[model samples]
Target chain A: MSSSSSGNVGIVIVSHSSKIAEGAADMVRQMVGNAVPLAWTGGDTDGGLGTNVAGILEAIEAAWSTAGVAILVDLGGAETNSEMAVEMLAEDRRARVVVCNAPVVEGAVIAATESSGGSSLAAVKRSAEEFYA
Target chain B: MHNVNASRAANAFAPLTASAVLVNAVGLHARPSVKLTQCAKGFAAKIEFALAPDGPWTDAKSPVKVMRVKAPQGATLHFRVAGPDGKAALAAVLALVHDGFGEA
Candidate 1:
């Protein structure tokens, strides 16, 4: 979604650990009640990690097709992995990849839940950046 | 105590050994698992866990394995360390769990 209109914002949070990822997601779910799209990549290398590059891309395309806005959060290894994945994408898709500045748990949950008003990926990242600042 | 952060807790892998303490507290399930995994980040080691008192230990860094032990409040879990800096990491995490995260 563009910044000028009421578009959906997809939010991602990466934590240094899987528990933090799930905790962050749980916090947001408690706050926002599942209205927002959430994805997590914790520090685990298991198959249950859910959203990786393929999953993230699929989420992005889904958001773009459905909501036209995508926001991603990567904590710890998730950050490096997600970034690497984004780098492998085309310019158009890569443009949508925005890493957040918020702490893995609190900041991420807060920013993602509060995201509205046609928030852009940059805006979400800005919120995350300011979250840490 | 030092504030726990993502970067500082990385790659500090440890192993799951015998535990004499059970993590006690309400709703205190996943937080420790998360902490353990996060603490394992950035270090050049691996982390795994096992239930204390005759439970099998699994990958400490794995959220699923950590949760499987279900080290609920008042439940003791064991930890082991087998990599670089494993001793220090094990000490730190064990202390955290032993203290019930300062809530016990």
Candidate 2:
């Protein structure tokens, strides 16, 4: 309900395959409804299997909220790219983002759900991290 | 641990308890699990769920714990709520369960 507010935490999904990233976002959207902010970016800009910091950075910016954003990446390169993307953010913004260590699909679900519930940044990150437990 | 949160309840207003069967073809899975966990969070009650009439009850508010019950079709889920809004919380969850989570 308060998602539009700055206190809302958003989710950014990154993967080597654009389909995988968008598909996971779609499933999370269905579960949490459209209220929770969500963004996904994957694949090379040329439409191949790879990741780019530019795309991942755009997703982080798009998902920005006062409550911060949690990143879920699908592969090793995606993870490294996501980290770089986080660093690209303004110092203040960078402090609010985190690369969650969990399965992308499950992490997206849990993060989106907790964000929809109006959880804090740390709480949402914890929920995403808990997916691995 | 039953008495761990005893003092949290206002009084012995009669905890609401109910049992429902899972009728949906896939039974308890991701979708239902999400819906159920969201439902459990709507109230201040401490909700616990059991797979059978006399089974071990775990916190229903936890998605992982709820999914661990492995409630297949025809499996009965027992829910118990204790708090000021226990009755209403129990009824809301029972209604969701009886509706097959709208998946049947």
Specify the highest-lDDT model's number: 2
In candidate 1, how many clashes are counted? 37
What DockQ, between 0 and 1, does each candidate earn? 0.02, 0.41
Report the CAPRI category for model 1: incorrect
Q: Tell me the tens digit of each residue's lDDT in model 2 across A14-104.
A: 9999999999999998876776778999899999999999999899888888888999988899999999888888998889999999899
List per-model TM-scores for chain B.
Answer: 0.64, 0.86
Model 1 Cα shift for residue A31 (angstroms) = 0.8
> For each candidate, what is the lDDT?
0.53, 0.82
Q: Report the lDDT tens digits of candidate 1 across residue range A1-133.
A: 1232225466665554567666877876654344456665555446455345655554445444233333445445566666766677678767666666556665554445335333456555565465445
Error of 2 at A19 (Å): 0.9
lDDT of 1 by residue, B1-104 (tens): 12133234432433334454655555235555545543553234444555543335455554334545666665556655556676766777677667665455
Alpha-carbon shift of residue B11 in model 2 (angstroms):
8.9
